[model samples]
Target chain A: MRSFDGVYEGFRAPVSSQKRSLPDSHNPAVNMASVRYISKVVKALLTFDNLIWYSSVKYVLRRCEEMKSGGAKALLSFVRVLVNIGWYAYLIVAVVTIIGIPHLLFRDYLPADKPMPWMEHQPGYTITFSDAVSAEGLASFARYGLVLGLPNLLIMLFILHNLRRLLAAGIENPFTLENARRMRIIGFLLLAGVAAEIGVNLITARFVINNVHIPGATIRANPLPYRGGLFSALLMLIVSEVFKLGVLLQEEHDLTV
Target chain B: MTIAVHLDRLLVERKMSLTELSERVGITIANLSILKTGKARAIRFSTLEAICRELDCQPGDLLEYVEDGEQPS
Candidate 1:
């Protein structure tokens, strides 16, 4: 295994050299001190080496190096393809959400007598409806679909666009200011997505309560617990700040002679 | 911004090219060029000492502090 001694030597080798040069004294104390120092140095070197090998920081740095050298071009290309797939898939879904939701109002309502598959297992309360859905109820549902789905889809489209550009730039140099800016935008959009989700849920929940009706079922619409979305947004924001700092530091390092 | 490098002047006075100085000082030409063009943010003491030694000049001869609006001497 490669050791960090070469790099560490450039930082500090004088102390180790001086310790090695201690005169050969008969005192056991001196011998013990030398032994202890050697052990400590060896431990430090091993620990440093292990950290370099095992740390995710090493992985990220190596990945960045690979990106800069075009070694990860194939992987980036693959990711770009996946992002493209997601971009178009969401686009189709967005179109369906827009067109299909309104179209549902015109379709024949579900059989008024038949139990809804979703309501079949209601344990205590029997779900009974006079009409499967009224025109107002269907219209509210369509409105909810558009209100919730469109913003999320648009945010995702924006995020994907930024990610595609970021990946493309990463293939050349991932350390540019523009890349950092793109990352920041993506982070904010992610945060906005979470907020939009909550907001839309609130709006649609109100609509559902006012417009939706059933005889025995008390319908309640609750906001989804988007913990993953929230966590990812916060993480992306932190990473963007770190990336910005790294880029600034890299600039300073390059300018330093 | 206030500390102006006199490397070009010193190099000319010493009758040495930047390449010759870079070779003697064991610094890359690109780095020396950065220093020459006044684009370098900071210089290592070791690099400064090496350049001074090769140029046979004091640190003050290679570096001068001027006011923001004043032209470099």
Candidate 2:
């Protein structure tokens, strides 16, 4: 039986050799083994390929880092960050001043009644000093100022912080994704604030008509006219939105390229 | 502004195609083109090694130092 087994093994070896030498035909088990081996080889090759790619990427990153730290590049980046921070600080001051000035001047005049027009053809309104001192009028002025000024101030601060980060990072271009994000946020806030202001004026007009009685009317009595202070504030807010849109466009262009 | 690269002239002298050299050196065609066109701001030693090996030349052959006001004839 052992001799018969050895003869069978020898026959099997020759048949396997013959099959390998043939052009097309192969055993199912042999084919499976070959497939496994090829797959293994491919995986090994892929590992090495990935290693090379990773090394190249690392090299490029290192080069960029080196450039970022270089003399003029580093100085420029610092300057840009400084300028951005300064600009935002200025904006904050401006917004605060604008909001604060009106309150400071008119704090005593709270809920100043809608002024009575003097001439039928003349288009001017006046707020008396007595009306500004009332409790409800003061509350109204404070609320208006806080609502309009706080958001603008906050937006400026947000932009300032992002710009500071970009500058410290030595980013080649300061206007990047970070600034774009902040601008979009500020834009939406500006729109909301403006809308809210419009709402407040509408509510204020209604309150004035129902609560206080005006004695004499000369010209048309629109509580809030086209050239009213609230109208100007809304226009300014709209302009800010436009500015944000411009900034967003510039950011998009940079990202696209 | 003062430094210049002479990779293109060297490649021309070696009578080797950029594609052939790229394949042999295991560098991308884009990088090789960048080097040849002198658009590359810097080169890595490993890349230099590969290029030297593929072209059968030294780094000196690929990179020539020309003085500030000197023009390559």
Candidate 3:
């Protein structure tokens, strides 16, 4: 937390006798690696399973930080590459799912002529829409996709943008006003996205129950009516405020020192 | 807001430059400027001790409390 760690080292030692045993937070490679690590942590915040894979990795990083190991940067570099690649892979998967869902959902791949064996006891006849304007199913799918996908997309972009700023500050200057503002933005965005999703889910369920007519039998709509994930967003907002206070205190400390 | 620093007066009296005081006290010149310019939010005991030791003065000699209704210092 103290950038003052080695300041006294240089002061106390004779210029020629000074050994360069310090955190290389200034190196471009190391800064970028830290950025990557922070980005990975941000991405991991959304997921529990992904964290399982990184549990050992995180512990190792913490130990390295504790030991002040200069060589740990090499390890951080490797982990940075892994986290960067994995995040891209994850992003690609989400994008593909967003694009592919409608393609698969609306296709006449299942013949509308008669219900396939899976439709047995299920009330809907397979209806294919030539155009989305006339078909309720197409409308529902498109609405659901936009409602669900857009918020998630926005939240991801916003968080990544904020995390980039935070990480670019590196370990020394993490408590900048810019980073605090970004964190606050991220917190608000997460809250808004989650709120919008829960609201849309209820609306979507209702739409399905009412508009998705399958020729008459009991058609049940599984409308997941519960809202969730507010606690995490609330916690993030609190953290953002703390960061703001940190920025203020950091300014005072800077002036003091 | 009412507290004022007389670091310049002390430095003048001691015939010591801010940079020399900073070097002797093991603090940066920028921080010394903060104290001299009265922009510091607070001062630490160690820093005060160092400054006091360097200047051969008491804390009260370098610091003054002006009441809010007092004329501009």
- Model 3 over residues A26-63: C-alpha lDDT tens digits? 57898898899998998777677667658978977776
Give candidate 1 misplaced runs (Cα > 4 Å). Answer: A1-78, A95-125, A130-136, A139-147, A207-221, B68-73
Superposing all C-alpha atoms, what RMSD in Å does each candidate have to the true structure? 25.3, 35.7, 22.5
Looking at candidate 3 chain A, the ten consecutive residues that score lowest on lDDT are A110-119
- Higher-scoring candidate on TM-score, 1 or 2: 1
Give one digit per residue, the lDDT tens place, for model 2 in A115-165. 322211222543333343444454455566555555545645655554455
lDDT score for residue A15 of model 3: 37
TM-score of 1: 0.63
What DockQ results do all the predictions give, each relative to the true complex?
A: 0.57, 0.01, 0.39
User: Which candidate ranks first by DockQ, i.e. highest?
Assistant: 1
Instruction: Please report the candidate that would top lDDT against the real structure.
Output: 1
